[model samples]
Target: MALLHRAELRPTKLELLAAWLPGRAWFGGEAGADLERVAAYRFDDPAGEVGIETLLVRAGAGPIHQVPLTYRGAPLDGAEPWLVGTCEHSVLGRRWVYDACGDPVYAAALASAILADTGQAEEYFEVDGRREGRAPSMAITVEGAHRADVPQIRSIDRVEDGDPVRIVTESVELAVVRRVGAHTDLPGSRLAGTWANQPTPLPLAYASLR
Candidate 1:
């Protein structure tokens, strides 16, 4: 479950992504003058220490871009290069954010979700310790799932320019589809999802490189 914060974030997510998106390998040309966040989803960290979120954004009227992100209290060890930027939270103070592709916590959660056939995390708002359910912007589904008992993630990398990040461990070669395709018709895809504003589900990623 994700605990929603009532406080505000300095330099909101969209602002940071706007500055960072152009340098990415998978970035298509600008669609318009303003970037808008179209859809969003989340994955839960069992430990409740890491914040995992997936954002689908459109630059004007361009193709929606999928960007997964991870938030941490401190710098992730050996992940200085993947840092997206730091921001001050109205409540949580300082947070170190990074591309989810490079985060072990994110890799583990994403891999487990695809392999086990899971969807987005349940969200809640904590008010003085009371939990209230929150709605998600997108829906998810797993196509063909195979269970992995404790699928260990050894390392992760970006093989090509952008999108389709590769996750490596001792078990499977999981490709996390950033920047989702028009349709999730990819063979061997373990998971797929539909944006709340979109009519059809699109392929998010596949796992089968053992």
Candidate 2:
């Protein structure tokens, strides 16, 4: 259970993302594009085996996007069904699975970090991906521990101009500002699988839940 610190890790999350973003349908590719990591922060897990990172990537010619990703020490067996895909780590000599939205441990930690306001020693908001004139004027705070039940956690908070939105994750609860105006809910069957196997839905579908 060796946990790799961000400082000690190479090919930083943005580097991995530069190579990985083009592969996703959500990315709007620009010719001869480059990706710069505008901001990044880590989420701590009690176990510390899995690495959780929240990153804001600025594409050379496209809008900045927040990409949350998880890195595991080893392949998660029986998780092939939930994985977005596997990429060969040139340095680690192992294939790392990319499934930021599905991993349970990562989800739980994200939810907890977003909700806790007792002044943690670690900084989770260091990664600022906001563009000029588009930055959120105010901070978004996680309301409270609504529920950590499986498949959904009902949490709400105000963002920007006091707009409230609920963040529901499998096995853990999180509350955040709904900047995208919508969120997609994963199917029930997909929600039942382990974090590594959970299915991801479009962000728009999440707004429908409200």
Candidate 3:
């Protein structure tokens, strides 16, 4: 299993966003804004070092937006072409870029994690979100590669508040939820409320990951 120290992971997260976010369609900025560390958490990865981080940032007069990101640092030399973007870290003084899900090892590890948590197979999972629209969102391709084994549903849940579901697979755990104001039905509606790990009486559903 590969895990990253919290210290090692945080700076890398900022470096990646600084490099990648400015180019994204959803990013509204002339240049990357200053990113502040709000809250962050970690996940396990059987294949490589995986870090899940959520950042709050103020960009060009827009309200604070939550930028969820994942990081892997296990020498993906040939995989550079698959990265979303790359930048030189002022601290690390090295270049870091976005993850590549097209790689089989990365994809398989992600699929295995989703299946272990949801009891669904790979072929049934579908990556659907407003951010994804017709094209699969970058996060989906990165975090959802292993979802091929899970059921195809609008979303998955482990809490009643409907915020988002966090699941652990192999060694990696991911916070799964729909983009705000994206889908109006099914799993999306289930996320309308805040998410809590404790128990609740909310009605939940399970669909194929097709």
Clashes of each: 1, 9, 22
Candidate 3 weakest lDDT stretch, 10 residues: 135-144
Off by over 4 Å in 1: 29-32, 148-150, 157-161, 182-187
- Candidate 1: global Cα-lDDT? 0.77
Ranking by TM-score: 1, 2, 3
Cα RMSD for predicted model 3: 13.8
lDDT of 2 at 57: 56
Flag the better candidate by TM-score, 1 or 2: 1
Question: Mind giving the per-residue lDDT tens digits that candidate 3 earns over 74-136?
Answer: 445565544654434443334344432323343333334444332211111223521211211
| Candidate 2 residue lDDT tens string, 1-210 | 122322433455456667766765556546467776554445665675666655555677665455656677677655553354444455454445554554666555555443343211143222356222222211223333433332333322212211122334433333322222222343211110111111332131111123
lDDT of 2: 0.42
Candidate maximizing lDDT = 1
Candidate 1, 1-210: lDDT as tens digits: 788888888889998888888788777747445788888889989889999998888786567788889999999988877789999999899999898877878877887787776668998988777998988888888877567574666566433335566666556666777676743554454677776657677877777646
Instruction: In candidate 1, list every pair of residues with a backbone clash.
Output: 184-203
